[model samples]
Structure formats: C-alpha cells, structure tokens
Target: MDRIPILRMGNFLLVTIQVDLYDRLAQNLESDLVQMVSKTGARGVLIDISALSIVDSFMGRIIGNIGSVSKIMDAETVVVGMQPAVAITLIELGLELKGVHTALNVERGMQLLKEKILIEESEPDEE
Candidate 1:
C-alpha cells in the first residue's frame, strides 16, 4: 500500500503525485486527503500531477471526489501540472472534472489558491 504524502503549507495542503497511481492507491489518496483537510482545517488543496502521464476514469473520479469533499469542508481544491495528453484523454473519456479548478503548475496553482481564499474570506457569511 503506497501512501501519498500531504504537505501542509500555511493554510493549504500540497499533494504532488510523482508516480502512476494504482486503483487502490488512488482511492486511499482520496480518503487520506479528505481526512487530512478535516484534521488540519486547510483552506486550500493543491494537487500537482505533473509526473502522471496516464489517467483513467477511476483516477479522474477520485480527483473529482477529492475536490468535492474539500469544498464541502469549506476548502478549495486546485489541480495542477496536468500533462497535455492526460487532459485530452480525460476530455475524450468524458470526465470533465466539473467542480475542480486547474492550473499549469504549482506556482500558478498556489497563487490561484491564495486569491481564491482571499476572495472567499472577503465574502460575507450567510446567516
């Protein structure tokens, strides 16, 4: 069982996937990530998949699940460093990842996360 490391940066959690993920591994990652977010109270999650050259529907769904869980926990999720081929494949496979945000790299993703957090913080809370 391979465990994906989740690094905490300020109010954000960074997940960098450097190897191809098997089904169980991906599933575990999703579960672990959601738990980490809840435990740490992170405001944002940055998933860097630059090293992944291949992704199937299951993997795509796991990513979507992570994003959804994060949002429900009041945190934003940003997927970064997606390979061009993987992006095309995901689209062709009909996995649009609707609720997940994307970025070209980690730096841009971090900036985006910060901006999003700021915008969210500025918004008035609903009674």
Candidate 2:
C-alpha cells in the first residue's frame, strides 16, 4: 500500500499528490487526512493535485469525501492546482465535491484558507 504524506502547516494540513492515485491509496488518503485533522485540530486542508493529469470517478469521490470529513471536523478543505482535464473529468463524472474550495495554485489556496479562517473567527458563535 502506498501512502501519501500529509504535512501540517500551522492551522492547516497540506497534501501534495506527487504520484498516481490508486484505489487503496485514495482510501488511505481519505482516512489518514480525516484522522490528521482530528489529531492536529487543523482549521483547513489544502490538496494540490496539479501533477495528476487525470482523475477517475473513484478518485473524485475520495477527494469529495476528504472535504466533507474535514468540514465535519470543523476544518475547511481547499483543492488547488487541478489541471483542466482533471476538472473536466470530475465534472463529467458528476462529482460535485461539496464543502471544497478551489484556487489556481498553492499560494492562492493558502490565501483562500486564511480568508475563510478569518471570516469564521470573526463571526459570532451561535452558542
């Protein structure tokens, strides 16, 4: 089983996918990422998929699952640097990827995360 490394960046978790994603690897990534969010109390997750030229439906679901789980953990998820082909594939596959934000690159992704965090922080708690 191949493991994709998850890096902790302050209040965010960074994952840069450098290798091709397989079913097992995708599953591992989803579980590992959600666990990491809980363990680290992260406020956001940034996934850079610029290297992947194509994404199958399974991979797309895993990505969506990661975002959904992160949100449940009170952390935002941002997917950045996705190639046009991959985006098209995901759309064609009808992968909505709810709760996921997107940016053009890592820098922009980080910025988006920060903005979201700040907005969340400034909002008054309902409780």
Candidate 3:
C-alpha cells in the first residue's frame, strides 16, 4: 500500500489516501498523521476516505488509535468522505470509535475545524 498523502493548511491537516480494506495502510497512515499533529499541533484533522470501498476491523481500530493520539496532542480528528456502504459496514461490525468524529464530506469537516479553531482563538484568557 502507498503511504497516505498529507497536506498542512493553516491549522488544519488534510489527508488523502486509498484504503485497500486490507493491509497496513491504516498503520502507515497513522504514522504520518501523528507526525503532522505533533509537529504542527494542528487544531484539526480531515481524513478523506472517499477512495475506500469498505471498512474492516483493522481500519476501524486504526481510526480509534488516531483519535486517541490526536486527543492526547490536543488535536481533533474528523473523518470525511466515508461512503454509505462503508459506514454501514463499520456500524454493523460494532466498530466503536470511542472519541473520533466524522463528517459527510471534506468541506463540512473543514468548516467544523475552522469553527473550532476560531472559537479556541477567541476565548478570553483564563488566569
């Protein structure tokens, strides 16, 4: 599997990759994503899963892992572009992503991230 593509835009990190439903794509992806979150302290992440045709246990676990790490780093995770079939499969499989967030599309995810950043920035300082 190919390494996931990553883009850093302002305070958001965008990831694009083809998930094969099997293999180490998820693990490889997490490595790159973790680096981005750690290095930039990015306020949010947009994971584009449009290319994936299915979601399996491995993939679901990886998503959960990414969410945990991101939370630890103070970054929010938003999965985007997940297909309907994939969504159903994940739900049926009982893949409970404890702390991960999802969006119907990348644009919406980006908007959510922007709002989060804006709110965080605008909050008054607490002594």
Candidate 4:
C-alpha cells in the first residue's frame, strides 16, 4: 500500500494518496489519517481523489469517519476530483457519505476550505 502524503498550502493541508480504489486506500489510513488531522492542527483539509476510479461502502465509511475526526479537530475535510462514473458507481452501490464536504477539483476544494477559514476568522466574538 502506498503511503498517503500530506502537503501544506497556506492554512489548508492537502492529502494525496494514489489508489486504484478509494475503499482500499481509506481502509489503510483510517486511523493514521485521524491522527494526522489531530497532529497537524490544520484548519482545513483537501483530499485529492483524482486517482481513484471508484468509491464503495468502505470508502464512504472511511470518508465519513475522517469527517467525524476532522470535526473534532476543528478542521473541515473536503474530498475532491471524483470522476462522474465513480460517483454513479458509488450511488449504485448504495454508498452514502454522511455530510462530508466535496468538490469537483483540488482548486475548488481549496477555495472552499479557505472560504470556511475566512468565515471563521471574520466572525465577531460573542461577548
């Protein structure tokens, strides 16, 4: 299994993992990813899935799990670049993601993350 690599871009962290199938890769890093989110102190995350060909129940679960962990770490997780076929396959497989953020590409994903950060930063303090 190839290791997931993490890169920093501004306030967001980009996690790139090469995988033929999203499920397998997610299974491999479920725990490690959770730890990574905690350790990095990242405000947001962009998961580049341009390499994945398909998504299954396993992948959906892992995505959901990562989102849960990211929430606890106060980081927003955005999955990016899922192919149309893969998206249809995931739907047909009855694989449902539990409210995790998603984007069509890395740039959009990063934009969304940055916007979230900006919104948070701009919020007025509640006295």
Candidate 5:
C-alpha cells in the first residue's frame, strides 16, 4: 500500500501526484486528505496533477469527492497542472468536476488558494 505525501504549508495542504494513480490509491488519497484537513484544520488543499496524462471517470469522481469533502470541512480545494488532453477527456466524459477550483500551475494555484482564504476570512459570518 502506497501513501501519498501531504505536505502542510501554513494553512494549506500540498499534494503533488508524481505517478499514475490506481483506484485503490486514489480512494486512499481521498480518505487521507479529508482526514488531514480535519486534523490540521487546513484552510485549503492544493493538488498538482501535472504528471498525470490520463484520467478516467473514477479518477474524476475521486477528485470531485475530495473537493466536496474538503469544502464540507471548511477547506477549499484547487486542482492545478491539468493537461489539456486530460481536461478535454474529463469534459467529454461529462465530469466537469463541479465545486472544484482549477489553475494552470502550482504557483497560480497557491496564489488563488491564499486569496480565497483571505477573502473568506474577511467575510462576516451570517447567522
């Protein structure tokens, strides 16, 4: 069983997928990420999938599920470094990955995540 490294950078968790992911690995990642978010009280999640060239429906769903769960935990999820072909394939597969934010690269993703956290923090809570 392989575990994906989740690095904590301030209030964000950074996960860079350097190799292809199988179904079980992806499932474990989703579960581990959600747990990390809960335990660390992370403000956001940055997933860099630049190394992956292919994506299937299962993978897409796992990504979406991660984002959804993170949001429920009050953490934002940004998926960055998606290849053009993979994007197209996801679109063709009818998996738009709703509720998940995306960026061109890791740098941009981190910037967006930070900005989001700032904006969210500045907003007043509505009762």
Candidate 6:
C-alpha cells in the first residue's frame, strides 16, 4: 500500500506530497493525519503540494477537509506550494477552503504556523 509521508517536527507535522494521490490514498492520508494529530498533539500541520501540477475537486475537498478537521482537533493547517493551475481549479470548483491558511512555500508556512500558535495562545479563551 502506498502512503503519503507525514514527518513530525517539534510541534508540527509536515506532509510533502510527492506523488499523485488516488482516492484510496487520499482517504488514507486524511485518516492517518488526524490520527497523527491525536497521537502527537501537534500544534500545527504544514502540507506541501508543489509536486502536484493538477488538483481535481476531490483533492481540493480533501485538502479543505484536512484543514477543517485539524482545526477541530486544535491543530492549525497550512497548505503551501500550490501551483497556479491548482489554485485556479480550486477556485473554479467553488470550494471555499475554510480554516486553511496558505503560504508560498514551506518556510513561510512554518512561520505562519508559529504565528498562528502564538496568537491563539495569547488570546483569551471565550466564555
């Protein structure tokens, strides 16, 4: 079985998509990632999709679902390195990827994750 690699770096989980994702693979990634967050109690998730030149609606929703689910688990998700075509396709699909933050690359995504964690930490919890 082929699987996407999810690397843990301190309080973050970094996923670099290096291959095309089939339906089963994408499903596995979603399940595995959430499980990883539960196991590691990660503060953030950074997903790199630079290798992918094409993204269909399924992939877009999977990405969006990852962000939403991770947020519910108290982990922030940042999707980085989206190609222009992928971005355009996502928009055309009418998918509003809520709760997902994006960056140009992994470096900026990590920085944004740090900032998100710090900001959320410093803010008072609502009643």
Note the clash tally of each candidate: 0, 0, 0, 0, 0, 0
Best by lDDT: 5
Pairs in clash, predicted candidate 1: none
What's model 1's lDDT at 68? 93
Write the residue-wise lDDT of candidate 1 on 3-116 in tens digits: 999999999999999989998889899999999999999999999999999988888889999999899999999999999999999889989987789999999999999999
Predicted candidate 5 versus true structure: per-residue lDDT over 66-97, tens digit per residue: 99999999999999999999999888888888
- Number of clashing pairs, model 3? 0
Give all candidates' CA lDDT scores. 0.92, 0.91, 0.83, 0.78, 0.94, 0.93
Question: Across residues 1-127, which tens digit of lDDT does each residue of candidate 3 receive?
Answer: 5677889998888887675744566777888899889888888888888998877787888888988899888888888898998888888999866788888898899988787767877787643
Q: What local lDDT does model 4 show for residue 62?
A: 80
lDDT (C-alpha) at residue 32 in model 6 = 98
User: How far does residue 111 in candidate 6 sit from its true spot (Å)?
Assistant: 0.5
Checking candidate 4 for backbone clashes, the offending pairs are: none
Better of 4 and 6 by lDDT: 6
Q: Which residue pairs come into collision in candidate 6?
A: none
lDDT tens per residue, model 2, 1-127: 6899999989999999988998898899999999999999999999999999888877877888898888889999999999988788788888766768999999999999999999988788744
Q: Which ten residues in a row have the lowest lDDT in candidate 1?
A: 118-127
Error of 5 at 72 (Å): 0.6
Candidate 4 lDDT tens digits, 7-68: 77766778775755455556667667677667777888788878877666777788788888
Ranking by TM-score: 5, 1, 6, 2, 3, 4
RMSD of 6: 1.8
